[model samples]
Target: MHDKTAAPENQHLSHRTAWLRAAVLGANDGLISTASLVVGVISAGGDAVLAGIAGVVGGAMSMAAGEYVSVSSQADTEKADIELERQHLANNPEYEVEELAQIYRERGLTQELSHQVAEQLMAHDALAAHTRDELGITDQLQARPTLAALSSFFAFLFGAVWPLLAAWLNVTFLFPHPLITIAVGTAIMLILLGGLAAKMGGASVTHGAIRVCLWGLLAMLATALTGRLFALVVG
Candidate 1:
């Protein structure tokens, strides 16, 4: 028996897939980019405080703008596709129903049962049935430009805090050059962030943590080398 009901809120766990991807990518960008900026600027004998501030603020804004534009474009495309689907259903509904049933059949339903399910579901909500079965789209999968933008912006801001604060504290209070401590802090934070995100997404925690940390190490190394080149040039 079909449940004949929707949970309203948790109807689709697939909805979180895009959000998780965007957020994890955004926050990792924020943390790594800002941290790299901090390390580079300080290594080049510049003001760490000012550099950290610039990285956090500038990187956050950039993340927000990029996410908004990219996700908005995707949303626009999906909207257009949905509109086209709606037209097809209106103009050639019988064909659409067959298409829906065929989709179910391809998913392992018997031909007769597939038709019955399609017919029943179409009777309940024709457009929804076609969209879900034929087009593989749903309300849960619809993109939200505003939500993507905000999540990216805030996630980046949150991730940037680790390296920025570590470098600043070491410089002002503990050490003359904070590169070692900054590296240590950044490595730990990246591991934690990746592990937590992977855990939430039911992915391998070790793999995620190692991947992010390795990339982070590379980014920082490249930026630090750039700082060295700049310092030599200035000299």
Candidate 2:
């Protein structure tokens, strides 16, 4: 039996804007930084597990704090803009209407029809219309500091845990070299994380995986080289 009243399956991905950026950035930073730190420590004959743990904790907290402050600043700007719009509407209602109508007219609507549509929309919800069409603020795209902070915090923890776990496994199993295990494991995880993020964002999986893994490997290599140089100098 065919169901004619079935809801539409198509959906836009823009709604993920609030948290997707924070999550992807935090996860990538955490994975690469923690892996690099651990590899460096291992190269320098230091404790890989300890360095991994410290890196994860410090990195996660820093990511959360940074995301919160940055997003909060954006939120403040949005609020100020919205408030300014409110003031303009209160002080000059007619001017605001014509302004909105002009925006519609620029969008291809006829002059008379634009004015009518603007008036009706303003009569219903002037602030919403102006905020969305004029100022480009919408509910889905609005800044939310708390959500961003939490997303980064958890995403960082998720990404950092892999390298830390690899380090621990190497120590526990007496692996020949912690560097090999940690670097390989971190690279694999970064590739997976990149592909997953890309899938969620409707991007190319192969491109994302290769891009993240390459950068992560480069970071770990550079850090490990610095550590080797430091070890040689100190010894």
Candidate 3:
């Protein structure tokens, strides 16, 4: 027996998936990329705070622009698809209706029942019914270019702040060296960011945190090695 009294919460998770993905990905990129840049510069015997600042600002702006362009392109494609669907409905409504009803039938409704359901839905909102069922597009999940871009921009900025601040703190002064401090701070941010992202996505926090931290470790290590190599060449 289904408890109709239960709240239909989180139904919009799929709708939110787009923005959530953009935000989390942008922030994660910002954190890892900037932190790596700072560590790389330091390993190469450059100033830590200066390099970190440059990396943070550059990374944030780059992330914002990239997110804007990407989301805008997506929005354009979705808009074109919707327009085409509209035209198809105008030109071949009966065929479209049959298509929609068949989709419902395939979902286990009786043929007559499918037809009735489609008929009623189409009569009430033909375009909506067709777009949602046939094209798998819903108003709730419609692409919002501006929203995505803005979200990414700010999230990236937020992520970039952690590493930049950590680098500025000269935590290595308290530790063995700058590398240790920077790496430790970055690692903490990575794990925290990963867990936060996972929680938002309703996934396993440990898995998410571990996965992201591992990647961060590899990224930092690679940067450290590259910086050391470059330093030797320059030295």
Which residue pairs collide, candidate 1? none
Question: What C-alpha lDDT, on a 0 to 100 scale, does residue 46 get in candidate 1?
Answer: 88
| Highest-scoring model, lDDT | 2
List pairs with backbone clashes in candidate 2. Answer: none
Off-target runs (Cα >4 Å) in candidate 1 are: 1-21
Where does candidate 2 stray beyond 4 Å? 1-12, 16-18
What is residue 99's positional error in candidate 2, in angstroms? 0.4
On the 0 to 100 scale, the lDDT of residue 195 in model 1 is 83
lDDT by residue (1-235, candidate 1, tens digit) is: 6566745653443445657766776788888998898889877988877889888998998888987899789888877877898899889989987988888898999999999998899899987776676667788777788887788889999889888898779877978659888888888989988887776666799999999999998999999999989999996
Which RMSD values do the candidates have, in order? 4.6, 2.2, 2.9
Candidate 2, residues 1-235: lDDT per residue as tens digits?
Answer: 9788986666566565526755776788889999999889888889889888888989989988998999999999999999999999999999999999999999999999999999999999999999999999998779989988888889999888888889889889999977888888998888888887777777799998999999999999999999999999997
RMSD value for candidate 2: 2.2
* Cα displacement (Å) at residue 220, model 2: 1.0
TM-score for each candidate, following the candidate numbering: 0.86, 0.91, 0.87
For model 1, the local distance difference test gives: 0.84
Residue 53 shift from truth in candidate 1, angstroms: 1.6
By summed lDDT, the worst window of 10 consecutive residues in model 2 runs over: 13-22
Go through the candidates in order and give each one's C-alpha lDDT: 0.84, 0.89, 0.83
